[model samples]
Target: MDPQLPAWRIAPEDDVAVALKPLETGETCLGVALRQPIPAGHKFALNALAEGSEVRRYRAPIGIATRPIAPGEHVHGHNLRTALSGELAYRFAAVAKATPVRDKGHRFDGYVRADGGVGTRNELWILPTVGCVGRLGERLAREAERRAGEALASGAIDGVHAFNHPFGCSQLGADLDGTAAVLAALAQNPNAGGVLLLGLGCESNQIDALMARIPADRHARIRAVRAQSEHDEFEAGLRAIGDLLAAMARDRRQPVPLSALRLGVKCGGSDAMSGLTANPLIGRMADAVTQAGGSAILTEIPEMFGAEKLLLERCENEDVFDRLTAMVNGFKRYFLAHGEPVSENPSPGNIAGGITTLEEKSLGAVQKGGVATVADVIGYGERTTRGGLTILEAPGNDAVSTTALAAAGATVTLFSTGRGTPLGSPVPTVKIASNAALATAKRNWIDFDAGTVLTDGIDAASDALLARIVAIASGERTRNETNDERAIGIWKRGVTL
Candidate 1:
């Protein structure tokens, strides 16, 4: 097979196949003549389809034909229509067993935590207990950074970041509960060595209540300060947070087993090159990480629209497969409930970059999950219990997805892009660009240039990507952090005030 050709057919039922490389008009493939130019990562019909017929990829129905599509015709959003399928109702009765592969038991230099989970980065985190105190938290973090030099140089702290949010104080019902849950999860995230909870004395969401929500065993590592009780002494809050940061800097990375590593994979601003270069390469890297006995997670429910079945077959057991199907159906319900079609996803940027349908986009998106068996499926903001490969329900929005990844206990992240973005998370995000041009153009932000996969052999490119993942896990700073693109976003399913 040509290095650019897709090595696997994700689904056995599909009559369309994705181009692993950029195939121009008239190109011969699988004994069929191309009817139109097909960009890499896009799909072409393997057989003619009458209007209303199913358009399949990854061996599942991605959409319905809007018009007659001749064999070799480009299959995309324009000629396809979103159609909800019965497979979405599929369910598994029990969870799957973990694959019986031997544990690699490798180790990376990381933060050794008392809880047993390893951290890729160690820093003091100051969280706004409520939205009202968000600014104060930010100020304290900035001050701590300035006073301590870089969090590394002063040997007191490497950095301080305020996890500010609009959802903290004024919300009620599920909204408030969700906010508190996510906040507490961030506080317990292994990436932080210590945390300072900054609260507004009068907010509806109290620091003490939030503290009670956290596990008592982890509570000792965190401290809280309220501004309203201090009689206008905001300076005291600043000093308290800053001092904790300095103390946190004294901690250092230690040798930790690879099983302790929890990694998150995400992508945004996708293009044709997205699936071809960055995503698939990251998928292979995910496999490597799992092989080393570490954890790798893939989420963003909407992006999983078309490739849900491929994931189902890979589920370790029937229960996981059921959970995976339910999650996909739930996301579709959410979209329809909002008076929108599920296919309305695959942003305009995707179309311009050669992705013509949600199915094509999804087939490529799930590549980040790699070939590993699905160990578990988790709800939004839930902690992953299984280790080999866990799938968390999340959105494709960069910040929300990264935030969910963090809440799921990922210590580091891998983000791919083709249209370019400056998004980063509280955790280190190693940005991988799909093409050489974007990598070089955004050199300061991209941690690795995956475009070489298109020019160099895919195997060689896969090796380079794996090397970068290991390096980042070992504590190398990603460009997003260095460039100060510290983006923090949460997924909101309801109103917030």
Candidate 2:
């Protein structure tokens, strides 16, 4: 065995180990000679296996072998196939322990709302009740920003912004309700010190109905206008936003405990290095937040396929376990009902980055949740009511899930990526790159480099990352915020009519 080859076996029971660098035929690593060229971020079999044998990574079954695989052979999609199928019964084992609180006395400067919600950003938001007036809302926000230029300069307000989506009209049943709920949740988001709800008089998601969903205390900071009700819609919107700006100007930041922080953990465009570097680093941050008496949310249910057991066992109780199980199986049924398989993931980008199966992808993705005990399971568009690590029901789609995270009240989101994307949520979306190459290549998109974990050690990388997160919570702009890449996508589950 060559001691210098960069390879990692995640656990003692793992039969395959990941190659940290390219390996040529005949090169030896971990006592196995490579039978073929193995690319960096790909896996190599540590021992021979027959067809149909379980292929292990992360010390669990990732897939079944399609053909007889020799020791040292490259393991990838060409030979590995996912074994995930129909829903399986789950039993709570309570494997994870409570993360110990360190009481570091850490704090961040945040805006505290009247409802006692904390905000990392104090901005004015313009939410359109229908897609027909989305552009109008944007124009209104721009005009408000122009009028409130001096207030913005004086730190009385962060900025005037508008969120535009293609839904809100022509949606029925759950689709309409989902749109309304998400929009209302966004309106109540702590980051928005004040909000202006703009609407077209005839829409499924009416302004009045949306307002009814918002909490009473927030009404003082919220204003509404119906485009069809006003002769000059743009002028009316500008006037409403002017009032919102005046109220927002009264909001100010105060020293808030770390326990007030609600963090959203996400990953996208992941590569093999994702599991080894970035993901685990995020896990550490998750642990820190939970230990500090704060809350952290983990979503992207479909990506939790093979690794569901890991989280299910961490549930705080049987009820939480049952809810989590239902959430996992329910998503699987969603895929099957649509004539698709549960393992039909690990996108094209993922395969290129050496993720062979959904199981492999899942094991890596769940690391963002850390080792904290699961406290609650929240439905889509529902706000998080409990602290500690909570599981949220949402799709694995980048924009959709991140939007759900924001709606669930995450003031800041730590998004880990390996292949790279310019996607950002309405809140401050901190982009964590899995590799140094991607970090250097996309400096404008990446906010933190997890690749340093491979060289500097996880402890140092995690400490540095936590510091960066606290800085962001104190109103530092992430790369996404600086690049103006903010967007949102609501999950549509029913007929469009």
The TM-scores, one per candidate, come to 0.88, 0.98
Clashing pairs in 1: 11-58, 11-59, 77-356, 92-322, 94-319, 96-317, 151-157, 151-158, 156-249
- By lDDT, the best candidate is 2
User: Which lDDT value does model 1 have at 79?
Assistant: 90
Per-residue alpha-carbon lDDT of model 2 for 88-174, expressed as tens digits?
888777556865745667789999989988999999888888889989888887888889999988988888889888788888888
Q: Cα lDDT of all candidates, in order?
A: 0.77, 0.90
lDDT of 2: 0.90
Q: What global local distance difference test value does model 1 have?
A: 0.77
Worst 10 residues of 1 by lDDT: 1-10
Clashing pairs in 2: none
The model with the greatest TM-score is 2
